[model samples]
Target: MSPEQRLASLLAMHGENELVEFKEAKNQYAFDKLGKYFSALSNEANLCGQSRAWLVLGVKDDRTVVGTQFRTKTADLMSLKKEIADKVTHRLTFIAIHEVAHPQGRVLLFEIPAAPQGLPIAWDGHYFGRDGESLGALNIEEIERIRLQNRADDWSAVTLPEASLEDLDPEAIEQARKSFARKNPRLIAELEAWDTPTFLNKAKLTINGKITRTAILLLGLPEAAHWLNPSSATISWILKDRDGLERDYQHFSCPLLLSVDEVFHKIRNLKYRYLVEGTLFPEEVEQYDPYIIREALNNAIAHQDYTLGGKISLVEFEDDRLCFSNEGGFIPGSIESVIHADAPETRYRNRFLADAMVNLNMIDTIGSGIRKMFQIQRNRFFPLPEYRLNERRVQVTIIGRVLDQAYARKLAACPELSLDDIMLLDRVQKQQPITDQQARHLKKRGLIEGRKPNYYISAELAEQSGDKAEYIRYRAFDDQHYKQMIIECLEKFKTARRSDIDRLLLDKLPDVLDANQKHHKVKNLMQSLKNQGLIENDGRIWRLSNP
Candidate 1:
């Protein structure tokens, strides 16, 4: 069938749905907005399990062909594909753009490929998806559904009969032997007595005495990567400076078991020393914890969706943070569940690979790794590990040092607080919003005080911890302070404009209030003074009543 007829048939059958977007670009359309639509429609197609999405230009919202004059030149239209690929995540672009001249008007049909499984398409680092007919941020629940789709299938479990023990790297195998022996000290002699293949089988890297994709990815020679075909077995370590500029980068391919240590060694984990209030000597600790780094890298390896052909990424910033990302969402839904649950993830994207790592002493599968990361940060009085998960990927960020010494000292002073409470307080210190339920709990415990969108640390606790000035900075000031400031300003200037009053009082107002709130506060104080015959504003300027 002709492309026009096929599109017409699709429109008649499907109308406008999640996978089909009709835009009446009558004269023209912005290129950037077009990119966003591509991201939205492509991700929608993935969620709907469709092969492709259609961006039908010259079509009205009601399915009428309005005829668009968008990018008349053929070359200009064709160049859009490359333009979009340049800015989008992973270089995903349109599959085809068909210009069909209909009887009434010309229709421009752009076919967008469905988002790859376990990897949502993003435009300029922002993910977009359809919410019925409205386009916005992909719903978290829908994101989770797309992420959970691969939980039942294990990419690492697929056996490759063509692959032989010869494909494995000898050095990697030796390293794996020592790691496995260390993990199972009681069977050290027995494990050392076995041959390489026997040891690989025991380590769960082999399937039914045969090498699998997991084995190739973890221990195979770099040249043996062809056995995995389209999928890559590369870990990219990137070092970025404080200004977000790339300082250096190194890619580790195959022999991932040994590459973990190599990547760790490349990072400049310098010693961080901080002086205690009472201690004579400063305490020294490594900026990045060794266990934290290995666990993060191992988690990335275990959860990466190899079918997507994306490489694991480890990004380090000179400002003291490490970010590890893998191309699959967190399996257990939320980080809170992982931090609080007694059990490991119920399902894994790469179960066989995770099992092998667990056996090889790379990571623990009992769910203690993530919680331990949080606890270790807490013990050091540093910010907890952050897990940023969406449909496309999971990124874990480990902060190395204290961001705010006052906040850290406050947390250290309060040892009775639970980890959950500490996490919420950390959010407050970072100025991140929390849910109303969390606010209520914090208020009930005297941990926080004030109204919505303007909460501050409890005044009593702030005073006790020597943070009273910070508390006053964030909390609303008493009415007397506002009145006095205005009276003093008007008295000094003899006549003051509202803007002048704003300049005098705005900064003195609570840090929690936005500009509009501060304006209202000043206006109300002036009105109250006027009512008592102390001050009055004539059109633009205010003056003392007696003056």
Candidate 2:
């Protein structure tokens, strides 16, 4: 193991309260705490002159090491790392996780690196400091000191002084007014009495009758878009085949609110059909929900990182998934926070621009856009919208229809499943790790089987899919299982030949394996099993090495 990993393992073995510190996993842990811990550990590592710090999981207070069996697979752990990097300052990441096998059980060792010089991490706009053994809020002076280290202006709110009313597109403005009326029917009378300038002001498009960059972005004429220096004020919609090769591309000019419909018109929303649950009759649904498309487009216009000089992009794939990505990261901590909570804590990258969008009815003010997207996907039996955040951008993917009917039907049969449950199941289908809670739900429904590191379609889901044996064979060889199988084969056969093992186990392998590639798989399995200390292999044969 590396030094950082060794340090973390040593800390965990000693006990959290005795070596490291312990704090309640509340809001910061509950909401923003991960970011805080990342920053605090990063800074503390610098102060102590240590290469790394430890964030040991499954421990309690008073130096007591109450081992936590809160098992998270490798992929789940990586997801956590990605989430923290996406939200934290400067995209700092954990060095490594060392899983130490202590006498008590397994202890997870999180190796956090020191903060970079002149840069401190901020979690959801707040900074934290370690006070003795407890974590307390950072003081104003320290916070200010950290803030001064990074100086970047908000680009979306910048005023376009040279642009005038003549630069605004009349057609786009008229369409914006109509959309506003549609969103708020009660404001129709008041809206009709107002003139163009008054409407623009009421819509929050313009500030005190002066044209802003937001206004030009949403409704600027082609020439006006050209006048906005540095970045092009256009939204590009691209349709790609399965290979990610662009088949078609189109650009739309501002005001984006009015042009959103025009952009939608460019997409081919054909009808998709699937069989009914009890009957063979096909049920047809719209390829994509109109409201979801509008919400996605509006969100892109509202939250875009215009300062980065990147255009908003909408990419459609042959798999019936639409990916909407902008040049900004999610201001809220996560997609889960947006869906679970009824009202989100007000936070925005482009405050003025977002407010303008709210007034124009382009986006919802109550922060229900994401929740609504989830609800729509659920109602349609389609995959829930997937949100991915990288260093400087957020991507939202909305799948149009159920690609796998067997999986969809199995999911639909379990009506008691929560959004979280469905999300976990989706992850499972995507070969991602399901949380402990999700694993329990799936087991309770008899839809999934296996313990940690061993999971597959349960007998119930397999029966529903009309292929019990096939499903079992596919999910039979989890990492641990495969390793164990190799050991068992060697013990039984004394000195098992590679071909002999392949003949015995290849038939029971998962569907992901091709019939033609069975020999290659056997070779790979032997290598993996040998590496895990479960078996030993010479050039020609293999035998059991460890119990």
Alpha carbon lDDT of each predicted model: 0.83, 0.70
Tens-digit lDDT string for candidate 1 (10-61): 6685567788889899999988889999999988998888878888999888
Candidate 2 TM-score to native: 0.69
lDDT of 1: 0.83
Off by over 4 Å in 1: 1-152, 277-280, 497-503, 513-541
Per model, how many backbone clashes are there?
0, 12
TM-score of each: 0.69, 0.69
TM-score of 1: 0.69
Best by lDDT: 1
